[model samples]
Target: MRNVKVIVQGGPANEEVRTLPAHKKNPEVGDKKTVFSSHLLMEQADAESFGDNEEITAMDWGNAFVRNKKTNPATGKIESLDLELHLEGDFKKTSKKVHWLSAPTDAHPLIPVVLIDYDYLINKKKIEDGDDFTACLNPVTEYRVNALADANVEHLKRFDIIQFERKGFYICQGTKDAEGRMEFGFIPE
Candidate 1:
């Protein structure tokens, strides 16, 4: 197993921190990135319609990585520790830069999941109009404009590939409601 590099969030906003240049590249790959961080605002995509790739577009999907390490109960040994999740797919359309799920591949590290919910609340308060939306995966989720019974169901139909439950995929779309604000949501299919 490869050594896993972890970047634990540190200190206060005012705290000074030092860093090495190599791991701080423009497109952080492997274990060098953070999820749901301020970087989310860096890639501002044009708001998309419901059930689209808004969240996907904002993400550095190509380089996204998940660490998988599990212990075997039989021998009480940890297996596959520091295993950086990987995807294997055909070179075909690789030039187009498709995600591992869409591309033809025997290695499917990210499986398509279902959309379980849309939005719940923040600090015991419901977001009145526009706020960043979140999802609960089953792997699945949805929104007001996005009904789980609608597009949510269809995205789970993995006709072309075998979607392993071990991994998951998230698709998000952000758009303005009748009242304008930055409202975003996570989609599970």
Candidate 2:
């Protein structure tokens, strides 16, 4: 079997679908075999807890929320619904798509890649007539994460642009360095 590095981008912050817990055990999630399953990549413990529970219904790609369950005075729920919630299952239905790269092996080796992300240089969205531009400057604007890219990245030279699926487009910084590190700068969408 080919070892693929599945990068799950957008999803609810709930622990059920977290990579730390869920994808750790089953790495083949979102693959062709179980791409359309409602409970794709759900943690074993959480799936067991929800055994036959009627309050919460697992929707596409293991996302779940309480619909109409009534329990006494009940605690409040913070409803944070992302517009991209349906991005996981049924390729025909989801707007966003998940990207995967081949894992490194003797036969099919992958390149070591660094993805650089950036936030706005300014903290304020709009500058009014008398707004102080210096004060509104954002202190932290750059973020970087290490990733493994498919072997095809080796052909990319400096300034080559490539889209990282749901992550957005990125420009190649340069060829692999002395440490075999290929860097890409994220271009804001």
Candidate 3:
């Protein structure tokens, strides 16, 4: 052969989908690609958990609650939900920028009321009116606040594969297995 010219060029290879663990904080979660099926660079991510090269794994989503202080028109009373629950272990990861959620400095405020009664409350789960939920650092956006008026941000029965597209990151909430536990995802996107 006299001569031949070839070119090999590309960015890092993307990973394929895989079954992530139900528990987010599982210590055995080694490398991300070692577990996660997808690893796209999150636009508002604080830092990739694995590293600049490795994508974060064991991601989760939840319907975080916010109790906006407001006076009830009918009663002219300020009835407040009085219980807050922060999952120390299950809240596997953290981030600084949550586009969907509104930070304190954001222009808008959270919905005046809990648009959808938490899944626990609807099932007669006995959530008291005076229940206090974790204070939302990133308040739910005005659009989300309004949308929630009709849209029920229901709970995912169990941990399932979450995906993202041009629209946004989506949590697939149809996991058949259930431990009968109710928890909210508080991390940022």
- The per-model lDDT (C-alpha) reads 0.25, 0.47, 0.25
Stretches off by above 4 angstroms in model 2 are 1-97, 126-134, 175-180
TM accuracy, model 3? 0.19
Best of the candidates, lDDT: 2
- In candidate 3 the C-alpha lDDT for residue 45 amounts to 24
For 3-29, candidate 3 gives per-residue lDDT tens digits of 111111121143222443423466463
C-alpha TM-score for every candidate: 0.16, 0.46, 0.19
lDDT of 2 by residue, 1-189 (tens): 112212232432332312221133455532221122111222222322332212232332432322222222453322111112233334444222323332234545656788888898998878888888888999899887766665566777899787654467899998555566898999876
Cα misplacement distance, residue 128 of candidate 3 (Å): 24
**Candidate 2 residue pairs in backbone clash:** none
Single out the weakest 10-residue window by summed lDDT for candidate 3: 1-10
Model 2: residue 180 alpha-carbon error in angstroms: 4.2
Global fold similarity of model 2 (TM-score): 0.46
Q: Rank the candidates by TM-score, best first.
A: 2, 3, 1
On a 0 to 100 scale, what is the lDDT of residue 153 in model 1?
Answer: 22
